[model samples]
Target chain A: MAATYVSYFGFVIKSVRGMFTGGPRYYAWLSFLVLLMAAGAAAYYRQAVLGLGVTGMTDQVSWGLYIANFTFLVGVAAAAVMMVIPGYLYHDKAVKGGVLLGEMVAIGAILMCLLFVMADLGRPDRMWHMIPPFGKFNFPVSMLAWDVLVLNGYLLLNLHVPGYLLYKRYRGEEPAKWLYLPFVYISIVWAISIHTVTAFLYTGLAGRPFWNAAILAPRFIASAFCAGPAFIVLVLEIVRGWTRFPMGDRLITFLRQVVLIAGLINIFLLISEIFTEFYAASAHVASARYLFFGLHGHDALVPWIWTSISLNVLALLALVSRRFEQRGLVVRNLPLAMLIVAIWIEKGMGLVFPGFIPTPLGEIVEYLPSANEVVVSAGIWGLGLFVMTVLIKHAVDIETGAVAKNN
Target chain B: MSGGSRIRPGDVKRRGFLKLLTALTAGAVTAPADAEAFDLDAFLQKHFHQMSDDEKRRTLQRLEQDYNDKYERDDFTVVADGPTPGVKFAYALNLSKCIGCRRCVHACVQENNQHRGREERGDQVEYIRVLEMEKGSLDLEKAVHDYDHEVPAEDKYYMPVQCHHCNAAPCVKACPVEATWQEPDGIVVVDYNWCIGCRYCAAACPYWARKFNWIEPRLPADEINPDTHYLGNRPRYKGVMEKCTFCINRVRKGLNPACHDICPTGSRKFGNLLDKDSVIRRIIDHKRIYILKEEVGTDPSFYYFFD
Candidate 1:
C-alpha cells in the first residue's frame, strides 16, 4: 500500500515539474504571460495603496471595466456546461472527449472572474467577510453572496474532476464511478446555476433599471450557452492546427450547432428586450435608450452597441450557412470566430455599462474606463490567458501521452 | 484633506493579522486597516458587537490616540456611542421652500467628514444629490442632479435626496457582513471598523444615498468635525461605504444635524417620528407627503412635502 502511494505521489511531482520545463516556445509564451501578470500586479499594488477611486468609477457610475469583465467572464465560466451536459448526461461520443477542455477553459475564466472582482473591490483585504463562521455572510438574500458561492464551487468541481480524470488517464485506469461522474452531473446543473446567479446579481438590483427584468436570466443563459461552447470550439480548432490533441471534427461541428441555436435564441431575447424598452415608452426605458442610442448627447456607447449587433447578425448568418464550411478550414471557422468576438462584445460593454448610464437620480455621467483601469483590465485578461496556456499544455501533454510513460 | 502626513498603514492588513484571526479558524481572507503609527490595541480590536465594554473603551481611546498622532493633532477623540431609547428619527423636506442652493450638500460634506472631491479630478463623494425638477411636474428623466445653475431658477423646484433611513432598509439587507444595519432609533448605521467595503449596499440603495470612500477620507485638521459619533461623522479610511446617519452623533444628544441646522430656508425638518408632538408627525398627519420610489416598498422615514 505504501509503495503504491509513493509511486503515485512521485508521478504527480514529476508531471508538475515537466509542465513547467518544456520547449523554448513554451518557455517564451509563459515568460510573456508572467511579464504581463507582473505589470498587472504592479498596477494592482498602486490601486490597492490608493483606492478604487484611482479607477474611473464614481458615485454616478459605480462599476466599470472591471465589473463588466467580471460579468462577461462569469458567463464564459458557466459555458463549460454546454459541453458537460451533452457529454456527461447525454453520453454523446462526439463531445465526451472534449469535456476536459471545456473544464480547463472554465478554470481559466473563473480565475479571471475572481481576479476582476478583487480588482473592483475597495477593500479586497476585507474579502474574508464573505466567508461564514468568521464574518456574517448575507446568504440566500444577497445575489452577490450567491455568486461568491457558485463561482468558487464551480471552480472547485472543474479543478477536482479534471485533475482526477487526468491522473486516472495518466495511470491507465478508469475513474471510480462514485468519485468523478457524480460531480460531472452536478456540474451540468451547477453551470446553469452559476450563470443564473450571476444574472440575479444584476437583476436583483432594484436600483439599476436596466438590469431589473425577468427576461435577464434567460437572456444571460442563452448568451452563455452560445459564448462558452463557442469559445471552446474556437480554442479547439486553433489548438488542433498546431498539435495532435485528438479532438474530432464531429465534436467541433456539434458544438457549432449548439452555438448556433443558442446564438439565435440570444438574438431573439435581445430583440424582445429592445422592443419592450422602446415600445413601453416609459422613463424606465431611459437606460436601454442610453445603451442603444445616446442619452443626453452622450452617445459614447452608440458605436459599441451597433458593432455588437452587426457582429451578432453576421456571425449568426455565417454559422447557419454551410457555404463557408464547404470552402476551406479558414472559411469554415470564420463564423465560429466571429460569434466568439460577438459574444465578448455583447457581454462586456453591451450588457454591463448601460445599467449605470442614467444614474438612479437621473444624472447622465458618461463613464469611460481610465488608462489605469484599462491597464488593470488588460493585465487581468493576460493573466487569464496565461492560466489557459499552462492548463491546456498539461491537458495536451496528458492526452497525447507525452507525459505518461506507459502510453 | 483630513490633516495627515498621509503616512498609511499600507501593510496594516498584513501586520498582526494572525492575532486578529486567533478567534477565526480559517485565515485566508481578512480586511485590514493599517496606520503608520501602529497601536496594537486598536489594530487588533474585536468587532463592535463582539467587543466588551472595556474593549470598547480601549478601542475608542486607542482610536483617538491613533488619529491624533497620524493627523498631527492633540484634541481628537473618537466616541463610540449608540441611539437613545424610545426615539425613532424621521426627516421631512419642504419642497416648496427649497431653492437648490446645494448648501445641504456642502454642509453634509463638512459635517460627515467626507472625502473632499474638491479638486477638478471630479472625485468628490457626497451623500446629498439635489435634483432640479421642472416647476409643474416631477420628471426624473429630465431632472438634473449635477446642474450648476443659480438657485431657485424661474421655472424649477429643487429636491435634495439623501438616506431615507427606511424601515425596510434594502441597503442593510444587501450588506453581506451586516456592516450597515438599522439601529433601534431607526437610523441605518455602518460599523466602519467592520465594513469590508464591497459597495453592494450602494447598488442596493435606490436613492444613491450611499457613498463609497474611494480614497482615504481627508479633512484639513481644522475642518475635522471633532464632535463626532463612531457611526456618524467619524473620520473614515479609504475603501468603505458611508451614508447619511441622520447625524446620530448630534440628534441622539438633543441637537440638530448640521444640514438641518444650516438650511437657510427651513426646508429641511427632522425630528422623532414616534413623538406625537413632533413637527414630522404633524406633517405626516396633516401634510400631503410623498416618499421617493415608494413602489419599491422601502417604507422610508424621510418624506417630501410642500407646505
Candidate 2:
C-alpha cells in the first residue's frame, strides 16, 4: 500500500515537472498568460484596499460584472457532461480518448467560477463562516449554500476521475471498472445538478421577476450543452493542431451535431422566454422591456440583447447550413466561436445585468463595468486559460506515452 | 476657431496628467490608514449569537475600543442586548398626512451612523427611500424616487420605504451563513461581522431595503452615533450587508425611532404589535391599511394606512 502511494506521488511530481518543459510558442503563450494574471492580481489588490466602490456598482444596482461572469462560467463548467455522456454511455472511442481533456476544461472552468464568486464578494475574508460544523452552513435553505456544495462537489468529481484515469494510464494498467465507472455516471448527474443549482440561484428569488421563470433551468441546460460541446470542439481542434494527441475528425463531427441540436433547443427556449415576458405584458415586464428595448428611455441593454439575438440566429443558421459541412477548418469553426460568444453575452450581460435594471422600486439605473472591473475579469480568464494549458498539456503527454512511468 | 486647433497636444497631455494626479491624491487621502494591518480580533471574533456571555462582553469591549480609537471618543459603547420579550414591534405610516419633506430620511441617517459621503466616494447609504408617486395610480413603475420638486406636488403622494422586518423575511432565508435573522421582537438584524457580502439578500428583498457597504463607511467622528446596538447601528465594515434594524436600540428602551420622532406631520407611528392598546395595533384595526407588495407574501410588520 505504501509502495503504491509513493509511486503515485512520483508520477505527479514527474508529470508536473514535464509540464514546465515545452516549445517556444508554448513558452510565449504561458508568459502572456502570466502577464495577464499579474495585471489581474494588481487590480484585485487595489479593489480590496479601496473597496468595491472602485467598481461601477452602487446600492441601486448591487451586483454587476463579477456575478454576471460567475453565472455564465457555471454553465461552461457544467458543459463537460456533454463529453462524458457520449464517451461513457454510448462507448464512442473517438470521444472516450478525449474525455479526460474535457474534464480538464471543467477543472479550469470551475476554478474560474469560484474565483469570480470570490471577486464578487464584499467580505471574502469572512467566507469561513459558510463552512459546516465550525461555521454555519445554511443548507437546503439558501440557494447560495447549495451552489457552493454543488460547485465544489463537481470540481472534486472531475479531479478524481481525470486523476485516477491518468495515473492508471501512466502505470500502463487498465483502470478497474469500480474505481472510476460509478464516478463517471455520478459526474454526469452531478454536472446537470451544478448548472441546475446555479439557475436556481437566480430563479429561486421571488423579487426579481425577470429570473422567476420556470424555463430558466431548462434554458441553462440547453445553453450549457450547446456552449459546452462547442467549446470542446474548438479545444480539440487546437489539441489536434498543436500536438500529436491523435484526435480524429469524426469526434469533431459528432460534437458539432450535438452543438447544432442543443443550439436549436437553446434558441427555442429563448423564444419561449421572450414570448412569455412580452405577450402577457404584466407589470413584471418592466425588466424585460428594459432588456429587449428601452424602458423609460433608459436602454443600455437594448443593443446588447439584440446583438446577442442576431448572433444566435446567425450561428444556428451556420450550424444548419450545408456550408458548415463543405467548408475548411476556419469556416467551420467560426460558427462555434460565434455560438460561444453569443451564449456568454446572453447568459452574462443579457441575463444578469437586466435583472437589476428598473430596480425593485421602479428605478432605472444603468450599470456598466468600470475599467478596473474589466481588467480584473480579464486577469481571471487569463488565469483559467493558463491552468487549462498546463493541465491539458500534461494530460496529453501522459496519454501519448511521451511521459510514461518507464521514462 | 478650427476644430483641429482647439487644443494643443502639450496642453491636453498636461491637463490629463493633472487630472490623474488629483485622482490619485484624493484616493490616497480617503483610503483607510488602519486597513493595512491584519485585524486578528475581527478575524477571530465569533458570531454574535454564538458567543458566550464572557466572549460577548470581551468582543463588545474590543469593538468599543476600536470605535473609540477611530472616532476619538472614549464614551463610545457597543451594546449586545437581547430582544425584549413579549414585544413584537411594528410600524405604520399615515399616507394622507405625509408631506414628503424628507426629514425622516435625514434623521435616520444621523441616528444610524450611515455613510454620509458624496456619491462619487461610494459611501452614500440611506435606509429610507421616499418614492414620489402619482396619487391616482398604484403602479410603482410610474413612481419617481429622485424628484427635485417642492413638497407634496398637487397630484403626488410620497411613500417612504425601508426594511419591512417581514415575518418570513426573504433576506434572512437568503443569507448563506445565517448572518441575518428575525429577532424575538420580530425585528430582523444582521451580524455585520458574519456576512460574506454576496448580496443575495439584497436581490431577494422586494422592497430594496438592504444596503451593501461598497466602500468602508465614512462616518465623520463628530457625526458618529455613540449609543449603538451591536446588531443595529454599530459601525460596519466594507463588503457587508446592513439594513434598518427598526431602531433596535431605541425601541427596546421604550423610545420611538429617530424617523418616527422626527416626522413633523405625526405621519409615522411605531409601537408594540403584541400590545392590544399599541398605536400600531390601533391603526391596523381601524384604518384602511395596505402592505407594500403584498403579493410577494413577505408579511411585513410595516403597514401603510389612510387616516
Highest TM-score scorer: 2
* Docking quality class, candidate 1: acceptable
What is residue A329's positional error in candidate 2, in angstroms? Answer: 2.3
Model 1 agreement with the true structure over B28-77: per-residue lDDT tens digits: 32333332333445444456777789888877887787778766788876
Candidate 1 matches the true fold with a TM-score of: 0.92
Native contact recovery (fnat) for each candidate is 0.53, 0.71
Q: Which residue runs of candidate 1 sit more than 4 Å off their true CA positions?
A: A21-23, A326-329, A405-407, B1-45, B119-122
Which TM-score values does chain B get in all models? Answer: 0.86, 0.89
| lDDT by residue (tens digit), candidate 2, A1-407 | 99999998889888998788799999999999998887777667767876787677777677888888888888888888888988988998988889888999999999999999999898888889988676898988999999999999999999999999999999999999899989999999999999999999889888889988889999999998898888888889899988999888788888899899999999998888889888988889998888888987778888888888898899889888847765777888999988888898888678888888778888877887766677789899999989988999999999888888888
What lDDT tens digits, residue by residue, belong to model 2 across residues B1-307? Answer: 1110011111012124345335433453344663424689889787877899999999999889988887789988789778788999999999999989889988999999987755433236778888889988878889877676789899899999899999988898888999999999999999988999899999999999998877777778898889999999998887889999988888878899999999999999999998999888899999999999998889999999997
Among the numbered candidates, top DockQ falls to 2
